[model samples]
Target: MNWIYLIMILLATVAGGMIPMLVRNLRPNLPIYMLAFTGAFLFGVTILHLLPEVYHELGHEAGIYVVLGFFVQVALQGLSHGMEHGHTHLPAAEGHHHHVAVFPLLFGLSLHAFMEGIPLGFNYSDASALPSLMLGVMAHKVPEALTLITVMMHAHQPKAKLWRILIIFACVTPVSAILAAQLGQHFELVTKSLAYMVALVVGAFLHISTTIFYESGTKHHELSRKKVVAITFGLLLAFLTLIFE
Candidate 1:
């Protein structure tokens, strides 16, 4: 709820979306590797830190929310086309371009971001977990931003419209966090709500991370060395974060 924390989250969100646009000249594969790293890091943090916290706080009942969150993410991907996990497949819009119906994708991604913001704001006082959760969310946002921008470009969306959507998406997280924080101040059951929300977010993270890992490699174990290194580094960083926590 602190202004500095909110500002940090906002800056991180904007940077994630803008950095990919700024680095257009870089090797395409670099972002892909980064996606792998972020995915692995998210997975590690969820499994190592968030899951334990949620179960410890809420008991076995929390598992139900986790399961629900897993399926909710699966459904969201139907609209987002797995963009959250770095999948950016889009049909070609070469000669005869048409405006793509990007609203569904935007809505899906925004909802996901909003859900993420709730736990972030609600748990801002948890000194041990807050930093890791924020970092994991920020890391996940980068490749997601890259994937989203790429999809819009492929669909021949106007630059102005694309920027509008990106800006809105960037704002959604902090706004949700602020709103959740305000609600928590007024609600008696805020702690219970936050616990459930955290469990849900953990489930969503599990689905996304597993999907990224499953899709990163080719048949016959043909994963790239760079991707392997990225994943390993991501895991190591997450472990260190856990230790600090």
Candidate 2:
């Protein structure tokens, strides 16, 4: 077994997941600019990296999953706001709150995070794909970690509780990667099944990326004119990086 992959992933799990928590704890209320920055990072990864990679590898079936992913998140977000969505709810100055996402909501949330890497993790044919996928996971996970931290801090929850939430979030990716790495090997002999799982995860990413945009918008006044400009620029850059990457 390549213990390096295992070690690198575990290191990333702890490193990537903890940075934002430390930031949030140090400053309980993050500025909107900071949140927007996180959103921009998300746009860069999802649009620039994750989505294009999925489509290139899986094509139209991946497209369908992307759309499905969007709808699923919309529905999930509708159910509630705050840590439940894995993001901090903006204060009264930013948005509203709901209690729909309780303990039971975790399964869907965890599954969403788990399936994030299923496409590139298990379904890719090229060896070069692995490194970029792993980097993208690390880079993008920063915002996800930030999101959960923001959610917990905004709720003014205790540090111990917040750490617990992050620890749980920490496992979703590494565990998924490990499982995908093992399971993906089997599917190499079964391309169709691989394609189907790829489609499912592509859908998940599509949903996730779009949801980030929606949450960024409505949760913080529905994409102000300034933000629209940021998003436009972000999307253009996203496409350009896709070409290069």
lDDT top scorer: 1
TM-score of each: 0.89, 0.65
- lDDT per residue, candidate 2, 82-109, as tens digits? 3222454433633545333334344555
Q: Which ten residues in a row have the lowest lDDT in candidate 1?
A: 214-223
TM-score of candidate 2 against the unseen true structure: 0.65
lDDT of 1 by residue, 87-185 (tens): 644454657773456888888888888877877776633465777877888888777777777677667677787778778887787788788788778
Which pairs of residues collide in model 1? Answer: none
Which portions of model 1 miss their true places by more than 4 Å? 92-99, 124-126, 216-222
Angstrom error at residue 80, model 1: 1.0
TM-score of 1: 0.89
Question: Which stretch of 10 consecutive residues in model 2 shows the poorest summed lDDT?
Answer: 28-37
Model 2 lDDT, full chain set: 0.54
Please identify model 2 stretches exceeding 4 Å from their true place. 1-59, 78-102, 123-129, 153-158, 187-191, 217-245
